[model samples]
Target: MSTEERPPKRPRNDYGSSDASGPPALQRSTDYWFDDGNIILQVESTQFRLAKSVLAMHSSVFRDMFSLPLPQDEPLVDGCPVVILCGDRSEDWTHLLAAVFPLQLFRTRNPTLDQLSAILRLSKKYDIPLPRSDCVRRLKCEFPTTLAEHDQLDTGWMHIEIPGDLSITQALVHLVNLAREVGLFSILPLLLYDIIIAAEPGENDHDNPNVLHHALRKLSTADEIACLRFHVRLMQPYHQTPLKWIESVPCVECTAAPKCSVKIDLLLGLALNAPNALIHEFLTQWDSHDDWSSKVCEKCLIVAKAVHETARQKFWDRLPSFFELPEWEELRKMDFE
Candidate 1:
């Protein structure tokens, strides 16, 4: 049998080798060499495109600006297409409100609560934004019974996009805490608490939305009614009520809380000057009634005095007392140094 001379070593597909444009490690299955031989690899459509644009225009001006380009492959869309990262759904009232964007990633149109929740699950699994409209519409309509399974907080319309730095879980906890204090119902807060408890031993990476969802579902069986009652009672200590007050009052542009309000200065003073011991103690038991006057020196007291005088107190009281303090906030801030 004349061994058919192995079809002239089938001239290698141009994609088999790395070039300036192609990622060396793209799964060989998807790799293909174009006739022009300009190697290009697909990455997540949006970010990779963004990166490519930036690279084509500004790469030379800024040394190593786009060192690691994101993969630009067609999004995997079986049950739902999942992207692989999120920017913590940062917010501004004038900008896209935080709650609305994530669900749009799954579908450009409406999504129900369940679909939104499923999208969130996919976001956690693959590390993408939960902004898909399909996901949100799905979640809102289904009210995702599965959401109760996540460890991340679902306070209001919030979610844990990232895990650690402004994570979805943190957002959920904040929403729950805010709701508890603001009276949006413990439904969200209780949901967060259940998940926080449930995400046991899982790294607080904020990167893992699946684990976050897994923990949150524990709320389905939780005593939410009781927790709501407790929070209702808890509100009395501050003489404040629900978010309805703020919601009812249009969040109009008010120069009242300017970015550099004097309170911020006081906080900076505290961070730079206060005794670390005092700062640490205050944050450790922020909710407790430990008197700052007892630990803080006269200098910190001066900052505290300024802090008490600012309009920031209203917003401050909403957060934990330790966080409310200028010294604590100042110290905690990344730009403090």
Candidate 2:
């Protein structure tokens, strides 16, 4: 019998090979290509050379995977087994690895929103508890449940440096989407409120009714409808309670009732015309407006402040209801669970 010549045995030591039968040539990760690493993870067209021990130490999923025996035909690169990571973005892997091995010089700086989002997602996926817990803590600090924490917050609570091209509206929308995906419902009310206020139309918006804010357009239809509905319903309680002083005849002890009444009317007009009046914190003390204190009496100011405080607390208590969400306690419980 004539012996049939078999096809030449495929080479097993072809490093960086891109033959037709093999995977496409992968670009080595600029930040994660460790020369001595024992495992090669390929995400999309990018390859990250990393230590298996380091990955197994941090992630139980990786530890368990490494404990299993590999197939006889497993592929290798530079003698390290190649693991093809499917259904994950290379950008996310970059962020996760950066967090895992943060540079010493930038250790003090907070991660940008994009980095935080990626860490939160990948850490959860890999069951890396430390980074995931830290991310959640930072997120809770930014999107607090209590009104007191919200009032005390600085202009920018999260980032050390926001990208110049990314507006506050875009950031809020990104955060809202991330929060929804991560099941962080406790923070959704404040995030949604911020989105609504940031996307409120300007005076010239009426001239172009069809023009939508870019950030508002990004919102899911369900969220867009919920926010609009909440805004409409908010006006009634807002005017009747926190701004009820506007409709009052003035404090009975007013030294100049007529003049005080005129100032109140002016304020009422301003409130009615203000785009975010419904969501504005009525209890916010206006330090720069000395005219209000000089024009309006101490007794009237005190009364207005008291009414505003009570109404505002009640509003915060029911904030989740406006967005058709579970109560704050329930939402918080969901987070812990």
Candidate 3:
């Protein structure tokens, strides 16, 4: 009688169990639910039915997990034990599984940024060496330690061949976070410099719409601060070394002092007025306009190129320091290890 209106009894299912307390319904993955699979890997509401032996062969973590004795009352679907993968995304699992079981055996394919990222994360988590090593190798190819390899990159800094919907700016932001997550510190200086250059108002505006705003919103606060600091700290070396020719008088063997002096002044103006001057590779010869080579005397041109090369090498050597990273050799060692 004193039973106040019991909260409307929770709805019951066909089995007469309350819906609120019953197990959540799972959706079998369309691609990964194999008829002969021996294990169910559930992430959230989706389940992947895969071969335990295959997974164990590839991943030490999985091998060890499978070696453990299961409880007598362990949940089973289609006679296979269910292993819920906590703190993992179904999409990431799909990527890793797809890589594990390729449609064409040994056929090389370049993964999109999203696919690569998912594979990298999951492979690292499960201690799958092959995929992890391949991902690291690809990343190093894109963001190499040596300046020579870097110089070979004609496409701008975010040139990792991300083939999909992900824009360059988005890929850059993702790569910045991913590199840190995976301990690829060697690539950060160049990557951060690219981000800083992209965030500069004019450089990123027309080509990459809203890049500045996107980067500001997406980048970690520490990375943002690092970029700001690098921008400020780089100015002294940027001006003093790479662009130091701006302050110098013409060469002693001056063939045309007035003309060479005027050219140097013009070069100085261009360097100063550049939107991303702090990160600009001033030593790089502009293919479209070699004004220094065309306008300056041969002797002066030779001297300028030499000075720029030496200065830029010094700048490159010190690049990792700007971002508070270890030297290039140390960073490279970390990557290999």
Candidates arranged by lDDT, highest first? 2, 3, 1
Q: How accurate is candidate 1 locally (lDDT)?
A: 0.32
What are the C-alpha RMSDs, in order, of all predicted structures? 19.9, 3.9, 5.3
For residues 1-337, write the lDDT of model 3, one tens digit per residue: 3559557654423323335656655688999999999999988668899999999999999999999999997767789998989999988888788888888877555777877888888888888888777778878778777777877776643423575676666777889899888777787877877776656656446677555566756788888777778766656544565766545448888788999898778777776666365455543543324655786887787776677777778878987887788899988778632
Deviation of model 3 at 206, angstroms? 9.6
| Candidate 2: tens digits of C-alpha lDDT, residues 1-337 | 3346666655542347677977666688999999999999988878899999999999999999999999998867889999888988999999889888877755778778878888887777777877778788888888889878876777665642457788777888888888887777798888887776666666666665433345667788888788778767756644654556555437777766888888888777776776365455443444434655665767677765566667667777888898888898998987731
**Cα shift from native, residue 236, model 2 (Å):** 3.3
Q: Please identify model 2 stretches exceeding 4 Å from their true place.
A: 1-24, 203-214, 247-249, 273-278, 281-292
| Poorly placed runs, candidate 3 (over 4 Å) | 1-24, 106-109, 156-166, 203-214, 235-238, 247-249, 275-278, 282-289
Ranking by TM-score: 2, 3, 1
Question: Best lDDT goes to which candidate?
Answer: 2
Q: Residue 215 in candidate 1 has what lDDT? A: 35
- Candidate 1 residue-wise lDDT, 176-251, digit = tens: 4433332223134234334333343343544764663453443333333444333334334211322112111112
Q: In model 3, which residue pairs have backbone atoms overlapping below 3 Å? A: none
Candidate 3 global lDDT? 0.74
For model 2, state the Cα shift of residue 93 in Å.
0.8
Cα lDDT of candidate 2 equals 0.75
Model 1 lDDT-worst window of ten: 89-98
